[model samples]
Target chain A: MKEFKVLMVDDEEDFVRTLDERMQMRNVDTSVALSGEEAMKKLEEDPPDVLLVDLKMPGMDGMEVLRRAREAYPGVQVVMLTGHGSEADEAEARRLGVFDYLRKPVPLDQLMRTLKAAYKKKIEQAMVAASFAEEGDFESAREIMTGNTKKK
Target chain B: MNESLFMGKVTAAMTHEIKNVLAIIRESAGLAQDLLAMAGDSGFAHKEKFLRVMDKIDKQVERGAEIVTRLNTFAHVPDHEIRREDLSSVLDEMLILSHKLSRLSGVNFTVGKGSTSVVLEADPMKTRMTIYRLLEFLTPLVGKGSEIQLKAMKNSHGLPSLGLIIKTASLENFCIDGILADPEWNSLEMEFGSENAAIEPSPERDSFVIHFV
Candidate 1:
């Protein structure tokens, strides 16, 4: 099994750093980005298997980050972790294809399980896309990686 | 800008900040616990005590987080001028928000076990304000060690209504006639009337019912 990679994006320096250490203690490869802009730059440099993002931030809030990530790196699963998101925000996030929505102050065990599930989903999608590519189905492989199936 | 909307906006923003602060506290405490667990039992003294204190911090964080979330929801009440809301839920939020008043007056507010859901279509802000005002009026009148049980029910006209069942420590000290005569009572009645609602003592004289029309 490859090392599970996650990029946690939030403006709260103390919170994200502490969480990053906890994830590392659990043997997961984790990195922290203080802002959405930093997160985007990191995604370009090295995309993680899963993107753990906060919905409310100072600049380029979580939804915009989720949108741009899905557009630029469709293979990476994005999970939304927010403290003050409203129902409307959750609906919008779901519409934009969030892997999971979790509230803040979440139990560590629960968060770990969610992250594992998200990472598993990302791997499964990649494996299926690779299988299609092996059969010379480049279009289907692209569709699988992008999570977009043909209309007909 | 409307006063209520302005207040709501400010409150919503502050609650978000409070939530972030709580999240940081929670994560920091969790990391401390994680480090302690990884260090094993050999190196650290009072490991059990430290773990116990961390557990307390975790519980307090949970409690604070719940209160902040409720307050954030309350802050958004002014977002809609009029909407359909369950009376029971509205009363529940009011009880939580009025904890300070409850402590000051030594009156506990709770929903009656037999309470039913009664959805009302009206101004959400006005509805909450009406309940808060009633609580303010009744808290001092009922005195200490009293309980105000809110129940949702349909009125004689089949309209949704709230019944405030006042259980005072001393029934002899509770005089409905005297309370109705107070100048504040008259003002409350006028306020209720303006909102297309009416408040009057129940037939038993021990409770007040607000009928919404």
Candidate 2:
């Protein structure tokens, strides 16, 4: 099986580092970005299958990152994990197409399940897009990849 | 800026910080547990003890998280001047907030079960403050090992009301007339009057009911 890749973004160094270590131990390929700016840079250079981001951050909060990521890299799934997120924030995240919104201090098993589900979604979308491309439906394939497929 | 709003803003910020602190502690302790599980019979003599301590830490983190969440919600009470709020939920939150005071006085605060929902449109901050003050006054009077069960109901005029049912081991010694006659009771009446509410002794005299307009 291909390695499941996840990029975690948070301002707290200790938290992100510990989470990274735990994910790695669970056979996940995990990368950490301490700030939203760093996360954007990492996404551009090496986009992962899923982005696990914290809502509150120093420079460029998670909402902006979610917006930019959805626009530029629609293929990558994004999940929000925050310690102090409000209902409004969750609503905004859902509006921006976030895969899931989870509270901080979540059990490792729950986090793992969410990440795996996100990765599976990414793969499923990619396969459908690939099928469209093979059939010479470039526009449909683009729509599938960008998550803008028109409803019948 | 309104004084209540300013205080609420500061409190909300502090609650956020506290939540972050708890998250870090939870993750750090969790990491230790993860490492221990991965160790797998490395002959660590204190493994069981460490696990037990970690369990305690996890439980505390859960407790702290709940408190911070409630405090955060309470801090936002001043955001609105008058809002429609469920009487039962308001009483529930105030009961949780008064846990320390109850412990200090050796009293237990509970919300009566199977109570019908009573929604009221009033100043959120003032409503909560009135409830807190009432609990504060009654906690000491009821003395140790007493129970104060709050119930939401309709008054004789069909107005929303909250009934404080006091139960103590020495019920014979508890005097509602004495409390009603105390000088502080007059002050409490004024406070309740300011909110357009009235506190009166129940027919049974074992409880007090606050009638809301």
Model 2 spans > 4 angstroms off = A1-3, A136-149, B156-158
Query: Would you list the clashing residue pairs of candidate 2?
Result: none
Provide the TM-score, chain A, model 1: 0.95
In terms of lDDT, which candidate is strongest? 1
Q: Chain A TM-scores, one per candidate?
A: 0.95, 0.95
Residue range A1-152, candidate 2, lDDT tens digits:
43699999999888888888878888898899998999999999999999999998988999999999999999999999998788999999998899999987677789999999999999999999999899999899888877777986
lDDT of 2 by residue, B111-193 (tens): 99644678878888878877888888988888899999988888877778888899987998899999999889889889876
How much lDDT does each candidate structure score? 0.89, 0.88
Considering the two chains of model 1, state its CAPRI-style docking category. medium
Residue by residue across A63-98, what tens digits does model 1's lDDT show?
A: 999999998999999999988789999999999889
